[model samples]
Target: MAPLMLFVVSMAQFIDIMNGSSMTVALVDISKALGFDSYSTQWIISAYVVTFGGFLLLSGRIGDMYGHRKVFLLGQIWFGLWSLVISFSTTPAMFCITRALQGIGASMSVPTALGLITTTFPAGPKRTRALSVFGGFGAAGAVVGLLLAGAFISSVGWEWIFRFSSIFSFLLFVVGYVAIPVIPAKAVTQKIDVAGAMTATSSMICIIYYISTGSASGWASVQTLPVLIAGLVLLAAFFWIETRLVKNPIMPFRIWRLRNFSSAFVAILFLQGQFQGFTYFTTLIFQNVMGYTSMQTALAFLAHSLFAVVTFTILGKVLPKYRLKPFILTGFGFRCVAALMFAFVQKSTSYWTLPFLGLLVHVIGLGTSVLPAQITALKDAQNEDQGVVGALYSTGMQLGAPLGLVIVTLISENSVDVKMGETPVEEVMKSYRNGLFGVVALGVLGAVITAFMMPNTVPAPPAAASAPTTAPVENSTDVATVATVGAAAAVVDLELDEALAEAAEKMEMV
Candidate 1:
């Protein structure tokens, strides 16, 4: 039952991730079918990203206050319905809007799924192994999405992408209903932080909108700059509300005090930024520069998918034995090397050469680093706060994808000084190489920050003997009573000091 539950949740993750990656491959076909320009086509992806990233924090907190299982089921239903709606889209607006609505569902589902894992699995090796499997499926989903999207597009049509997602989502909902155990809410009395939710969600939407459009619209243009500043201001306001206004904040400020959690958040942000950007450019280079069919482009990523699965499987066994720092560093190191190799890629480069090798190394980095980060982030979290903590970590990833894409797009566009369709093959290659260098720079930054900020080791769990037990006392003699009282007093003092220290540390971190 436990393994089946894990499978259901993991497949939910896989389906969500696969939806986005598959859409990437189908974008051109969709654009042509809908009679939209390239500029408008980008909104298809952006719409999903904005709503997903924006709502994640609130959704996570909702899962914590309500029940994860209930929220997960709701999200699954919402996602399936929206996916079905998207399949019938006749215009870009219809597609984008339905996609955005679908993202709301993803926002609800993902963090809650993580919450379920944290609550169900006891911390330490069992939890670590569960997280690794979850992360592995997610990693595999990205590549598999590409593979299936190509096949779907080539054979039937791009519309089937959403149709399939809808079918899978509904099926998942049915299976999940039976498999997932109902965990009760930690605090049913806690009120939703409406002010914080509004501020945070709006700020994220603004910031993401700016990032999504800045390259195309001009960074300083009215459509981009004002929204960017507004987003920042709202973000500042959200922090203020969280710290002062909200009694039960959507994202509690205290969570930032956990050094590993904070570091993991930053690490995942940079890691995802590089991954999204790298994948974007590589896909373009394959289809546009090398003139490969969509199916071929998808096949090119097969090696990456295989390597990621194998790496995660191995890491699941190895992680419990070693500290995570080395793996994190090694993961970033792999990314740096892969990006550098890609930066030198020629138009004529063979699939079996640099492309294959780079994919292999890049997947290794993803497998090595991401699972460890997920484990590290959850390690210090109290069971009740798991949903929000996971949400925050995922929010970083959501934001990072668009941020990375914008940075690379801006860099590449400026480097070549020519529009994509109009550029010569040599210039296009040069632009892509320049964009990869940006990924290399991001990798270096992530590695350096992670090395310094991430703790070398997490504190060990308390021993079972030290844990408080509720069994009635067998004896109530005076000497035994006194001994019990003294021990309880000492424990109380120790707990108070620990709590105070944690409070002070959280303040300092903030």
Candidate 2:
């Protein structure tokens, strides 16, 4: 039962990562089918990410307030339905709409899934192993998506990706209903913080939308600056409301006080941004510049993916007994090496020099950072807050991809345009160099954030044979609030259940 539940949780997480990577391969084909230019088609990818990242906090909070199982199932059903819509989308606008819906579903599902894993296992070796497998599967899914996308696009059609995801999502939904244990609410009737949720969601949407459209529409265009300004303003407003307005704000400012958690979040943001940015541009370099086929590109990524899985598995077994900070530090060092190699990649550089060696260094770095960071955050989060905190961690990751894409694309777009003249290979390489430099700068900043902010040794969750463990919670005040909310929520749930039962009886009579 424990293993089955773990698989269900990991599978849901896999779907989220797979959706992003798979869609990336299908981007070219989808553009041709939907009659979109390069600029317009980018939205199909960006829109999903924007919505997914924006809603993560709210979705995770919902799981914390209500029940992880309830929210997870709801997210799955909605995602499956939206996937069906996407498979048959006739226009870019329709595709974008359904894509956003799919993001919403993913947002709902991911945090709750992570929370469920944490809730089901105590914060010792069991939880550590589970999280390791979870992280490994996530990396593995991206690799699988790349391979599957290539094969499906070549043999079947781009539409099959959507169809496959839709089927897989539904099957998971069904499996979840049967297997996932219902986690009782840790808090009573928690009043929904409608105002805070709306403000944060709207702010994120506006900021991301502005970034997504700004380059194509002209950064100075009438629509861009105002939207960007508004988003920042609203985000500021959200911070204020969370701090002052709500009794139980969605993302309590208190969580940030933990030096380890706060630093991890920041480093991951930069780390994820670079990670996502690398995949996008590298794929372009291989397929567009070097004229490598999708299958070849997918094959290239496999080595990195395999290495990541191996590292995660090893980390899972060892982290429970050892300190994680050193591993994190070492990880960042590897990332720096990888970023430098990629930054100076020559147009004529063979696979052995730039692509293969650079990626090997990168994957090693990525595994080191992620395994330690995820363990650090969840290991300390209170039992109740695990769902939302897990969600926030993932939001940092998902946000990085689109945010990185927008930033790097803006920087590199001007240099890579085709014209009526002879553009040298060196010029193409120059644009890539610019993007890689951006990645390297971010990586250096990430290393600094991790080294200074994270502690030398964080207290681990008490092992079975060691001292008695208190529930992992950095903030006592937040824990008190979660309890109060959980208490209030039970009454409302009973009332809701009764009302639904009555309504069902009435419908049967009719």
For model 2, residues 417-469, the per-residue Cα lDDT tens digits are 64313666667766776777677666777778788888776545556424343
1-510, model 1: which lDDT tens digit per residue?
678889888998999999999988998899999988967877878889999998999899888778788999999999999999999999888988999999999999999999988877766666778889999999999999999999999999988898999999999899999998765334325679999989999998898888888877889998789999999999999999989876778887888999989999999988999999889888888877788999999999998888888988888878876889888889988987888877777778888888899999898889888889889998888766889998999999987888888787778878887676787988888888899889888888999999999999943353422444332221124337757887999999999999999999999999
Question: Which candidate has the highest lDDT of all?
Answer: 1
- How many clashes does each candidate structure show, in the order listed? 0, 10
Look at candidate 1 and tell me the lDDT of residue 124: 64
TM-score of decoy 1: 0.89
How accurate locally, in lDDT, is each candidate?
0.86, 0.79
Evaluate residue 55 in candidate 1 and report its C-alpha lDDT on the 0 to 100 scale.
Answer: 92
Cα deviation of 388, candidate 2, in Å:
2.2
